[model samples]
Target: MAIFNTRDRTIECRIVYYGPGRGGKTTNLEYIHRAFRKQTIGEMVSINTTGDRTLFFDFLPMGLGKIRGCEVKVQLYTVPGQIRYGSTRKLVLKGVDGVVFVADSLEVRRKENMLSLKDLQQNLAEQNKNIFKIPLVYQYNKRDLAEEGVPIMPVEVMERDLNSKLKIPSLPASAVNGKGVGATLKECLKLTLHHLQEELKWAVQDGL
Candidate 1:
């Protein structure tokens, strides 16, 4: 759920980048921070935990305009994808308004991607959130590896494996090179803000 500050006329929401370990979740954030300097509000904070790190930063999108007369402020975060960090991932996912699942494109990581997605579903369920209903996007990352002659899953296969049932928006990306990073985030933000608007409408109707 997004926090609406009636006094400040601003709404703050969280969007988490989630996927298997070394799946380029952090890379997406890093690229965004570097590429979208005008929108980035603060330093990208990282919390290191053994083999993985959790990162977050604030972003204020310009052209999306206000929601219900409140300026929208977004906080982007990346959950440590290592399986051992399940608790941390759940904590970060709390009160999430949207999600970007960064699925690795490497052929060897096919099962890992599936497992991470299942982990996400379970974690969201624990918070009384429905993965199916939530604003979510799939990013098939590391497409550049294919140019290096590395084994990578075809976009169609990745969709069938991870997104066939969800049928959400999915984009092929090379996060390290900033390819599709903006587009991925842009789509997620659009969906999230639209979802928030509907929620706010319902809340107002219910006299909340």
Candidate 2:
């Protein structure tokens, strides 16, 4: 659920980047912070936990215009993908409005990707949010590894393994190189804002 500030005329929402450990979630945030400097409102904060790091930053998207006369403020976050950080992952997802699952493209990580996704589904369910209904996007990261003679799954196979049932928007990306990063975030933002619009309408109608 997004926080609606009637007095400030602003609506703030959270979007989390989730996937297996070392799946390039942090890289995506770094690229966005570097490339979209004008839209970023604060320093990118990173919380280190043994083997993984959780990161977040606030972003004010431009050109999408206001929603119900309120400016949309987005808070982007990445959950630590290590399995030991289950509690932390759930905490990060507490009030998520959208999600970007950054699956690793390496063939060896196929199982890790599936497991992480299942963990996501369970975590969302715990919060009374359905994974299928939430605004979600799939990003198969590290496509560039293929060019380096590394074994990587084809996008079709990744979709079959991860998104065949959901059929949400999925993109092949090389986050470290900035490929598809902007597009992935853009698509997620579009879906999230659209979802929020309907929610806001209901709130108004219900006199909340």
Candidate 3:
């Protein structure tokens, strides 16, 4: 859900980057925090466990200027990707307005990718949000790892495994080097705002 602050004429929306452990969710947020300094309103807060994996979530609050009379603010978050952190992941997803699913391209993580996506759907269901209806995008990260002799799944195979049914927008990215990071965030933001616009129209129609 989006928080509309009437006093400030602003709407704050939550977008989460979700995926399997070590899939570059945190890297994406870190890159954004570094790359978009002017747009960022607050310092990014990241809590990492011993292995440097996100323990809770990485938060970056940013202002995206005004849209349709309301100042649009966005809170970007990355849920803890480790399987043992399932409860924390679910809690991070509460009131999420949009999501970017970061799928690891390593061949060894194929099953982990599928399982993480299923976990995402289950968590969203718990929050009463249909996974299909909500604004979602997929990021196939670590594509550059093939150069180092790392076995990686082909883009087509990843699509078949993760996006066969939903068929939403997907991007190939190496978040560590910042490739496709901005594009992924922009697409998610676009979809989220569009969804909110539709909801606003419906609310007005119902009131009328």
Instruction: Choose the strongest candidate by lDDT.
Output: 3
lDDT of 3 by residue, 85-194 (tens): 99999989999999999999999999999999999999999999999999999999999999999899999999999999999999999999999999999999888888
Q: Local distance difference test, per candidate?
A: 0.84, 0.85, 0.92
TM-scores, all candidates, are 0.89, 0.89, 0.94
Ranked by lDDT, the better of candidates 1 and 3 is 3
* Candidate with better TM-score, 1 vs 3: 3
Measured with C-alpha atoms, the lDDT of residue 181 in candidate 1 is 93
For candidate 3, the per-residue lDDT at 200 reads 49
Checking candidate 3 for backbone clashes, the offending pairs are: none
TM-score of 2: 0.89
**Higher TM-score: candidate 2 or 3?**
3
lDDT for model 1, please.
0.84
Across 140-181, the per-residue lDDT of candidate 1 in tens digits comes to: 999999999999999999999998899999999999999999
Off by over 4 Å in 3: 201-208
Total clashes for model 2: 0
Using lDDT as the measure, name the better of candidate 2 and candidate 3: 3
Q: RMSD to the native, candidate 1?
A: 3.9
